[model samples]
Each structure stands twice: as C-alpha cells, then as structure tokens.
Target chain A: MFEALGLMVFYENMLALNNVSLACGDNQIVGVFGANSAGKSTLMYTLSGIMEDIAKKELMAGGERITLRGSINYKGRDISHDKPSKRAKAGIILCPERRRIFPESSVLENLKIGGYLAKPAQAAETLEYVFKIFPPLTKIVRRLGGFLSGGEQQMLAIGRALMAQPKLLLLDEPLLGLSPAIQYWLAKSIKEIAEERGVAIIVAEQYARPIMPIIDYGYILENGSAVVEGDKDELMNNPDVKSAYFGA
Target chain B: MDILIYGVINSATLALMALGFTLVYGVSRLPNFAHGALYVLAGYICWLLLNRLGLPYILAIALALGLVAVVGGAMYQLILVRIRGMSISEIIASYAIGLAILEGLRWGGLKGGTFTLPAFLEGSVDIAGVSVDFQRILVVVLGALLVGLLYFFVNHTRLGLALKGMAQDERAALTLGIDSDRMAVASMALGSLSAAIAALILLPLGSIVVEAGYHVLIMAVAVCIVGGLGSWTGAILASFVIGFAQILTTAYLGAHFQVVVAILAIILTLILRPSGLFGKQKELEERV
Candidate 1:
C-alpha cells in the first residue's frame, strides 16, 4: 500500500510536483506518465527518501508533505520521516533512474550490497529468488556492472532492488534507453515482480504503451501536477492524456 | 645479494605505507593528509610508552597502536568529516593539520630532540655473505603478512565488501542501506591502524621526530599515485617498483637524491598516466 497526500516537491525556486497526490492499494502497479522534466523522478525520489537536501528544503517550503508514505501506514507510523537507509529497511526500495548500479563492482557484489538491507543470512535465498526472475543475471554475476551491456545493467539494477525484498517498489523509467525487444522482456519481468510478489509499484515513464499492459492505474503528470488519474482504460482514452502523452 | 635483500625491505616498507594511503583515498575520495600525522604519532606514542612510561616492549606497541587508532578515528570525524561534502580543500586542510601535528610535536619537544627506537632486535643475521639486520628482516616479513591480512579482509569478509562498495559508489552503497558514515569511520580506523603498524616497524629505522612522518608520507603519495588511486593491486605493484628504484638511487646516487628522484617519478607518472598504471578512468557521465 502507498499513499501521497498533497505531496509537493520542488528544486530551488522551481516547483517540480505541486500538491501531487496518489494512492496505490496492495500489489497495484501505478504507472505515472509525464513529459521530460515533469518531476516524475523527483516524485520517486521523495517517495523513496532519496530527495537531496537542495530539493528537500524547497519541497518542505512548498507546503508538500508525504503522509503515510511507505508500506507500513499513511497516518503517522509511515517511513516518510525516516532516513533512506531506514526506509530501505522498511522495504521501500527504489530502482533509480539510470540504473545507478555500482559500475566498478561485479554483478554479484551489487546484489550482495542490496542484500545488506535485511541480513547476510538471507542472501543466498534472495539471490536464488532474484535469479529465478532474471536468469540472465546469474550468468554475469561475476562481471563488473560497467562492462555489462545496457540491457544487462538494467536487469542487474532491477534485480539488485528485488534482493532487498521491497514491499513497495518504485521503478523510475525502467524502459528508458532500452531496445524494443529488451523493453518487452523487462516489462514482462517487472509485471511478474509486481504480480507474483504483490509488490506495490509507482513507475514513472514517458512511454506508456509498454507499461500499459501491466499497470492497473495511471496518472498523467502535467506541467507541475497530476492533471489526470484513473484506471488504465479511462486514463488511456482521456483526450488530454492521448494528445499530450501518447501524441494521438 | 645484499642490495637485493635491501631492495626487498624497501619494497615491503613502501607497500606498508601505500596500503594505508590507498585505503583512505579509496573510500573518502580525498587523500587523508592527517595519515602522516597518524604515522608520526604512532612512533611518538610508542616512544613515550616504551621509554618514558617504562612499559614493556610488547605492551607499549599494543598501547601505541590502540591509542593511534582511537585518535585517528576521532580526528577523522572531527576534522575530515567537517569537509565531507566540500571540495579538495578538505584534503589540503588535512595535510596542513598533519604537518601542524608533526611540527607541534617537534616544536613541543624543544629544538627537534633526538628520537630513537627501543632496541628490540639489534642483532644482524648473515645469509649467503649478505648481512641483514634481524629487525629489518622481521619488518619485511611482518609487513607482507599485514598486507596479506588486509587484502583478505577487504576481499573476503562481508563488511569488507560493503566497505569496498562504499568506496566504489557511496550514494549507491547508502541506498543499499549501508551506513556510509560508519563505513568511512571504520575505513579511516583501518587506514590509521595500518599506519600505526608501519610506524612500529619504522621505529628501528631512525630516531623519533615529528618530521619523521613527512618523508614516509611523501613516499606513500608517490606509490599510491603511481599505482592508481583506488586500485590496491596498482598500489602494491607500484610500491615494489618505487621501492627498488629508491634502493638503486640510494646505492648509486646517494641517500640525499633518493627522495628527489621519487618525487620526480610521481610527477612523471601523474603526467604520463593520470588514471594511474592500474586505475580506470573516472566516468564523467555520472555527474551529468
């Protein structure tokens, strides 16, 4: 479960997400469609507590607050106030944009660090679980992330996030920079992660068609706000959504 | 044969110092200028415990190392941590602080008083017509063992892997739930601790002086730069190369020019191969 009440975030003097609010029930895949610079990444960063200090002060001043922001609850006990590390322990893991894999480290090393969120003992089981989802990763676990092809690095990044056993997974532009074939494969894997694990997701993306098959709900982020929100069918056919996002 | 044995000792010493330097730079991305302070402090601490306090040799050594570890850790947090997100000024300030500490010890000691190591193992051992001091041999063996242990700790243990990950990408490591500040402190402690060990071996080599850490630290900078900043393998290989170069220079040109030649070598390496002999070029795409 995830909820953002009037969640407003901003970078210095510029509003990114203004009074933006959304909610996702357990295991729901909520796809956020927006043009470039629509604050999708900032929204994900704020939700995951990775919002930098510069943007954090601006967002707090912009009167935007994340209420009950994590998997636990929305009223008060939520991890909105928790540090990034604590939030991760609370199972609010984010697969950041650009993959953000430790480039110099091996694939296994990246996965191992992700496993540190819980405990060392659970690593083997986590590794096995992750490998089941992305078997290609198991073969290249020893290779450095920098050496991995773009598609492979994306897999490793998402797989590393899975190793954390996140209850609420935030995928930021997973399909960005991916080829059509690889994008299809990654979308399938992401759907499986959300469906099989019941891991709630809030993915931010420019391309909506690839994620439309898996996403239960959709929110269209306009200039600085979520101008439209509904079930996939309703929002997919909305005139504004079609023109601004799908270029229909 | 004697020259070769001396070269081995030289290599071992250079490796020991470079290990500490590289460990600090690897994680912090800043060359810890205070590391030399730790080195010089280690010797002074040992001297005070052994000669002034009249403690037994073994006890003194342990106390000195433990003391330096605590002091090093604290100083890193107080001074180094203040400049955590700042620019290269942190490194410059750290070096200044280190120099200040060394000079303070010297000035505090009244006209750079004599510094000497406790006569732990003074005898010499002759091997195949090559006479080497027992202490120097011990330093070589013990240094190798320490470096080996450090290598194992960094490469084998889970905590070590976490630490190496932090060095690789601090933000990503933190996102994985590793407390990066804790890792940094631990890394600094280990780096300073290694400096302490090198100081222990360095005691017999020369008299104790605050300035004693200066040259050794300079040598470490050369070795680390030549090897590569974050590459442990590079640091080790460069240490051997520099160590042999130093010995050859000392034997042929004389001791006074050894330091100059080493400095020249570091500048040349920095110019020729800025990425280091073994280090990868820094990826500029991340900042964008």
Candidate 2:
C-alpha cells in the first residue's frame, strides 16, 4: 500500500540514499537489513517525511544543503513533500531509533501524547490495546519513561507509535541494543502486531537473524544501496546475504 | 507577619510575570522577550477599550486578552516562523517586537504613568492585623488559580499533552502528528494570554506605563533564568526565592535595591547551578 520510487537523498556532496526503491503491501512485514552507515536510517527518515523537516531546519540554520529526489505514493497519494505530521495523519508513523521517549513524562502520558491525532474514543481503545500488547507496560504505567529499561523503552516506543494509529509503521532498528532473547521475543510480537492490527511494518535493522524469520519480504542494504531484494526464504538462502548477514 | 504576608504577594506577582515567558519557552523553546510588551499591551488595550471605546470592564478585559493572543500567534506566523532554528535571531526578533510595541505605545501617547486600569474591586481588608488591598489579594488569588488551571490544562487536556510532548522532544512529537509550528503558535497565544492576565490584575497596583513593560521583562527573565528556562515548577519556586529576597531587600536595604536583588539572583544561579532548578542538559549526568 506504500511505495517509494527511486529515492535519492544527498547531504551536501555525499549521497546518503542512492536511487533506492522500496514498497510494502498491506499487512506485510518488510525487513531492510544493513550494517552501520548503510543509509537505513536515512531511508526511514525520507519515507516518514522527517528528512524534509531536517532539510528545512538545516537550510534555515545555513547548514548542509540536503537534496531529496523521490516520489512516495502512500495509499495512492503523492506525499513526498508533506510534513511529518501530515504523513502521520495519513497513517504513516515512524518509531524512531533509540526510542526517543519523553524523559520527564510518565509512561502513560507518553502513550496519551502519541494519541494526539486520534479521537477520544479511538485513543482510549488504542490505549487498552497497547497495554494488552505490551503487558509489562501495564505494571509500570506510572514510571517515568526515562527510567525504563532498553527493552521496555522499545516496547513503549512501538506502543506509542501504535497509539498514533498507523497503517504503515516504520520501525527503525527496534532491536538495536537488546538481548537476543528480548530481540526475538519482540520480533515475534511485531509480527503478531502486523497480523493482528493489519498494519504494514517496515523494520530496518543490522541484526537480521531475529527479525528474518518473521518478515515476508526483505532487502539487504550496503553503502546506501539495496544490493539484494527477495522473499524471506530466498534471502536466507542467498550467498551474499548469507555471508554478510548470516555469517555462513 | 508583615514580611510573610508581603513575601507571598511578591512571589505571586513574580510568578504571574514569569508564567507566560516560561510556558512559551517550555513548549517551543521560543524566548518570547516580548512577554513584557504583551503584558503592557493587554493593559493598554483594555484601557483603550474601557476608556476610549467606552466598553464595559468585563468585555474590555476579554477583548484585550483575545487581541493579545491574536498578536502573539500572528507574530509567530509572520516573523518568527521565518527564522526558526537560530536562537540568537529568535531572541533578537522577539525582543525587537517587544521594543516596537512598548516604544510604539510611547510614540502613540502612552507616556508618563498616567494610564491605569481600575481594579475589579476597590476596598482593603485587614488580614491578620495588616491592612491589605483587595487588588493585591485578587492578584494572589488569581495567580494561584491560574497556576492550578494551567497545571490541569497541561496535564489533562489532549492539546496540552501534545504541547508537553512537543516540549520534551520535537521530532518524536512530529511522528505522533503533533505539528511543531501549530503547537508553537498555540504556545505563543496561551503564553500571551497569561501575560495579559498578569497585566489585568497587577497593572492596577501601579500603572500601565512603558517603563513597567521593560521592568516586567527583566523580572520575568530573571525568574525564568533562576528557575531554569522552560521549567514552570522551577519558575514558580525561583519566583518565591527571588520574590522574598526582593521584598527583604526593599524592606532592609531601601526599595532601590529590589531590582538589584532580581539581577543578583539570575547571576548567582548561573554561576552556581547554571541550569536553574529543573533545567536539563547542563547537569553532570542525565537520564539514560
């Protein structure tokens, strides 16, 4: 339901995203695997229209001249130049890397704040659903977001994004620094969320082993380019992906 | 007993003055130096409506507040939005707007401490054997009420929660569909409204003079700096600290040392704490 065509992002003279194309169908989990500095975060930002904001801020501050060349068609609307809020309202929400939860706000407050665009009834229902999905959050509902563990923060981040009622959720390194057990468990929960909520999820990660089993389709990014793209099984058996990602 | 009674009133006055400045900074990090100008602007507008236009007091206060809110939002929409990422420019632009408003009023015949708004009530009551005017009592009552109302609004309401989110992290707020520009506009309007409220109650104690505008700005900035910029609780607490200090200074070291006390509070906070009470980012270590 969401497709980005020939996405190219340039920071000053360096190409951050070099003519990469990606698409995800409804209710699908698309994993984009890449090592560090492989343009995964850049692509995620470009998709969520955050790059436009960054570009604007940089230009206003007379910093780097960021160049974005792409057409993102979401649900048949060309939203390449829309603001992040506009994109979010259009059911595109990005759960950013590092889980930038409001440090001072309580966990419940963070979730409620995420429901900014939702109607009161929708927000209430989503709050219930979020707690149901992330059970640990229910116990620590009163704890400050800053005090949460890394795994808890990731759950809160995803739950917070779910509160935004996204049809296409962009997960940027959801399991960056988690233990393997939590990573796999969280990956399973992500798949269930996709299947149950019917929201398409695009997870960009460096560690592919945990998320690989849950994704339907995947892309392997290397140095700002998607060098390999295929279904999950095809990717697991591919020679290049195996060597780089699977360590086979 | 006198110092205690007067100290509470003084702190309330300082809190009322700094609330708007801290709020706008809290939500969007926009240092609205025109906060003082807006306070004077509200009083002057109300004076014009009540006297020049012959409107009722209630209607005049309401209309003045509404107009100030519009001006605040418009200031952001027209000028500040254009210079959004640079802090120095934001301060300069806002302070310049403040100068234009205060000096423009001076240029337009708002001179020499003659203009004053009538108090909502006109009687003094003896409180614990001390004679206290009704307007000063009203300032304290309204100030406390405003703080409670503002706390409820920010914590309970959706827009307020959205604003709080924006204050914590702008980009994270963005992904949740909370538009920074829109929230900033809302913050400016709300902040300006608080400034007008302070003007309505406190301006009656003295006069709606242009000099008071600059004085209010200095006092507000001093309170916010000591309280930690963008931290309202810190602002209120710092107000009490500086407020009592100012009152004590006025009582003991002559009234002329009151302003000196406020300025001294700001410098000392910077030297010692640096981030005020609740301010983040300048501390030795922060939350993980």
- Chain A only: list TM-scores of all candidates: 0.88, 0.99
TM-score of chain A of 2: 0.99
Best by TM-score: 2
Best model number under lDDT: 2
Please write out the lDDT profile of model 1 over residues B160-210, one tens digit for every residue: 877877887766665666666677778888888999998888677777776
Would you estimate the TM-scores of all the predictions? 0.90, 0.98
Q: Return the TM-score for candidate 1, rounded to 2 decimals.
A: 0.90
Query: Cα miss at A9, model 1 (Å)?
Result: 3.4
Q: DockQ of candidates 1 onward, in order?
A: 0.43, 0.83
Tens-digit lDDT string for candidate 2 (B69-122): 999999999999999979999999999999999999999999887898898899
Q: What's the CA RMSD for each of the models?
A: 3.9, 1.2
lDDT of each: 0.79, 0.94
**Model 1 CA lDDT for position A163:** 78
Q: Looking at model 1 chain B, report the run of 10 residues with the lowest lDDT sum.
A: B110-119
Per-residue C-alpha lDDT of model 2 across residues A93-159, encoded as one tens digit per residue: 9999788998889999999999998899999999999998899999999999888999999999999
